[model samples]
Target: MSRILVVDDERNVLTSFQHLLGKKGHEVLTAKSGEQALSLLGSNSPDLILMDIRMAGLSGLETFRQAKAIVPKVPVIMMTAYGTTDTAIEAMKLGAFEYTLKPFDIPKLTALIERALAMGQLMRTPVTYGAADADARAQRIIGKSSKMIEVYKLIGQVAPSNVTVLIRGESGTGKELVARAIYHHSQRAERPFIAVNCAAIPETLLESELFGYEKGAFTGAVARKPGKFEQASGGTILLDEVGDMSPSTQAKVLRVLQEGTCERLGGHETIRVDVRLLAATNQDLEALIRDRRFREDLYYRLHVVTITVPSLRERKEDIPLLAEYFLKRYSRELQKSGMRLSPEALERLSAYEWPGNVRELENCIKQAMVLGQGDVLMPEHLRLGQSSAVQLRSAPESLNAVRELARQHLEQAPGSAHQHLIEQVEAQLILEALMQTQGNLAQAAKLLGITRPTLREKISKYRIQRRVHLNQREG
Candidate 1:
């Protein structure tokens, strides 16, 4: 059952909704005025809010403004005896889910309530990141690598400010988690966090989606609608895959960034917004600027602060901790809490380079939990890329893995594959050479056909240790 808040001045109106919605299996919270509703909101996490436009102490509009700051993601339906006006339109433009005239049809209102409840649930499930957040419904970004620590530091430094943050990383590297982490820590933590994927929505509709539209703006534009930027006023809006945004939308977004004001599509009124912008992308924006596909002005605006998340392969040392966390988390989720990760399974996870990063590992764990029968999650259940030990055992498999990695690099970051692959192979070769020579730099350089000075420089560049030992885990 979901929770619903019904706020009104009339005792009869509140009583009616409490009885009517309670029968529909809702935990109804009744408030006699907007002030009481705001108080209830502070103490409760209601899925849907039904409030009157006119009330004592504070008008519904004023109450809504404050309520949004408190629970921006929750859907609110405003009831008013007064018909459509600029005031009502202003309320909708400011992110009220719907404005319904009083004495609304019971069936239609119930349907609206259900829809609002679902929409709220979809967006309001807070993303738990750090260890201190204990929301059971949330997920944590588990990693303690030096690179991840740097990311945490960046989030802490920039989250408190309103500067636009550009989160750069490969797909599935948990960029959104970093964004949410920043949101959770920011001053606007109580406000909404709206994420819009520029790549997911079509270019034609992207503008209207981000900036809303007025009725009759285009074909089938039946009524006025507020865009995400307007809905996210006084909150945060994350533009994921923003590199894919069209030039027109980029200009409009640039305007918002520059002036904090935007005109809705097909509407002339300028809507001043207060939103913290966070853009995440896997694509190379600098190259896009060079190619003239992306605007340099907008790029600079977003680049005021950038947090680059390292790829999984770049931080392989964290794989054990990440994999173990996922294993335990998914076990609980899949209702197979008895299952555990085997030592060999963890080895396979660590030895393999994850192309899809944390998201792929999560899926691997969930699938293994759902499919594996015994107490242990094994290698066969993994169906993974070549792990270090396995690849070394088979030349063909090693070649295949190498080819796949190279292909991925070339596809993901064009023009970097040559140096990337060279360094990757060179690092591995250096590790093996050092192991063969017992970490003697001279002997290792001779075995690898490289000069001692060059090998030493490469080791330093790669942050590799001069001495090697087999007392601990894999190299």
Candidate 2:
């Protein structure tokens, strides 16, 4: 029997957890807030903590941070609702064992708890990834941000199994890199790794491309062509941008997933292939399912263990590391030794919302390296597109833009729009200033055209924690 701590702001949820776990013959402790959870930790060391992501005061993420400091070895499992999945992912990056959506399945929850408890013991042991073999497997993947660390952990946990994985992120977020990472770490590393971009291939040929073709199947079909599925037999096949696949193709893919067999376009023989399928897409598949653009059955077939890659903006703390990595990479490729990014360049890079994600950042660094004259890349050398330029505008222009945005939001929204819009704008401006100044309150205030005291008060009012360190002077 294990002692579990259940924390949530909802009294009913606390009661339900107590009743459920009590019947399992486990000792359960309950807390209503983060403070209460921390207080409980002083006297009782539970084997696991199950907590809600959103609470009244201290958020589950903040609470998880504190709890880890208090009891580092104890595993924490966060419970989140629909829209708060990203926050729960962030919590996972901060050392939470795992997260489950609210109204979770009882069987899944029980299985997760059992696994967490068993994994807790393994986590306590000192594990190092310094071996040359392990380093070689993960060399392409960079970023030490908590979020990326979480991704790394998940990859390590899931790569060995032949599980269907759905990698979701915006374009340029390096979903393919992640897919490759899993392939490299898996037992099938020696096998061929084939990648097919579903969107890039026309729907007319996608079926043939994936499932192969028999001789004389169509015009210009002179010979038998083994499709990607056949080519990747005993290996991994990554279906990139899979959401764009046609319904017929989706059905075929679903058939392949379900039956593990596919027939060539004109052949009657069913080809049995042992291939691991990995699907990636930037689109909201659930929304697509609602609109009937995507097949819900196929979505379920591929979403066995979903991994949502964090956008670059969401993990801004990793900007410097990524920038430096790109710098060295491009420098060596271009044969320009001793290339580096300046502090101002890094600060701008960090402050910019990378809509194109990591892919855009890499291109910007490469462009700067190509055009930049000196060894050190400066702010002027970087071109982050029109969006970034707008983001870097003078305070007055930014304020005016925010005012217009708030006006539009108010016009469209109902109920307390004015107050909400004002608070939103205020918080955004303060957060941007802090990000640009790398959490230097005085510099941020100066940039925002506000007094330090006023900025401090605003930070407190908004409960903003300056965490990005992009503006640190480059060494």
Candidate 3:
């Protein structure tokens, strides 16, 4: 029988849990507060913990963190009321096994407890991957946030297996990095790692890119060329933005996953390739399935193992660490050594919602490194356009100041003064939004309170040019 620890501030809750768990032929230990829970943890060494989120003394989250430090592998199931649901989610990101809402069903709670204990046992078992490979893979993913720690653990668990992996996250959440980390730690680590962006390539060329055609097979087929599948033989191939694949391409990919063979474009020869498939997407595949946009079969095939990377907003505790990492990196690259972020700047970063995730933060730091005057990065040096708009809205003086500047510009211009002022304000807002969104036109449009088509039309009329970066163009 497994041993369980139940922690709650209420006496009735402790008694009820003990009675429920004891009836199941398992040992139960009870604690009324976080202090008692921690004190019992070392001596009791329970297989699972059911703790409340809100306690009088030390909070449940703090107690969980401390408990994990003492016994990292033990599973913790947080119990929270409706008001503390968000805190429960934060606990889950911080490595909690799972969470159950207050007034949870008895059967469901018992089942959850069983699953958590089983998972704890599995985690404690030795992994097949070499320690060195695991360490190296962990180093490539740079974040100590609870969410990131969960991701690292998932990578270690899934890399040794040959199953297909689907990485789902927002556009700037480093899906590609997760794929690479998996490949680096896998059994096929010595083999090549090829990445193809499905959304970036045209539908017409996607088939040819995945399955090469023979010489003289088509207009551009002057030489026999191998596709990404053949090129990534005995290795891993990351299909970035796989949700953007066309129906025909999806059919072919499904065939490859099923039969381990694919036919080249305009050729009858069926080529067999051994490659581990990793797919990444910022889209909702289920919604696409419901809409008949993405193939259900292909989705199931690629989703043998799914890893959802947390967005920057979901893991805000790591903002300072990520900011510092980017600061040191960009500083070294830009030859501006000894640069650091100020406490106020870090606070501002933590407060802002990072819609663009880690990539946007990196860009902001790089921009600060280039444009900032002093060694220490300040709040003024960071350009959080959308977030800055919030601050400006809160303080009417800032908006008035901008309006005053526009008025002055209008007064100074002679021909088409109003038109000139409007153009200037629009252009500046467009640029700032573009910068914050890393030149993503769709996101910029959303920030500017306009539709994409309208934004594109205005960009053409204003003759606006934006430099393309990694996430600059919309899928």
The local distance difference test score of each candidate is 0.80, 0.78, 0.78
Candidate 3 per-residue C-alpha lDDT over 21-129 given as tens digits, one digit per residue, 9 for 90 to 100: 7766578999999999999977878888899999999999999889877776687888988678667756754557667888878978978887787655543433222
User: How does model 1 fare in lDDT?
Assistant: 0.80
Candidate 3, clashing residue pairs?
none
Q: What RMSD does model 3 have?
A: 26.5
Best by lDDT: 1
- Give lDDT tens digits, candidate 1, residues 1-475: 6788888899999889988887665789999988888889888978889888877889889998899888877888888774544455578767887667667789788777876776576466555554644577766777778898888788889989998999999888999888888887789876767778899999999999899889889997756778889878888899999999999999999999999999988999998999999999999999999999999999999999999999999999888878777777666445567777788888888887777788777766765665567888887778574222333434787678878998888998788888888888888888876775567665555446454556766887777784464222211
- The 10 consecutive residues of candidate 3 with the worst lDDT sum are 128-137
User: In model 1, which regions exceed 4 Å deviation?
Assistant: 1-44, 50-73, 77-88, 97-138, 383-475
TM per model? 0.67, 0.54, 0.54
Q: What ranges in model 2 sit over 4 Å off?
A: 1-139, 386-475
Give candidate 2's TM-score: 0.54
lDDT, candidate 3, residue 357?
A: 82
Q: Which candidate number would show the highest TM-score if scored against the true structure? A: 1
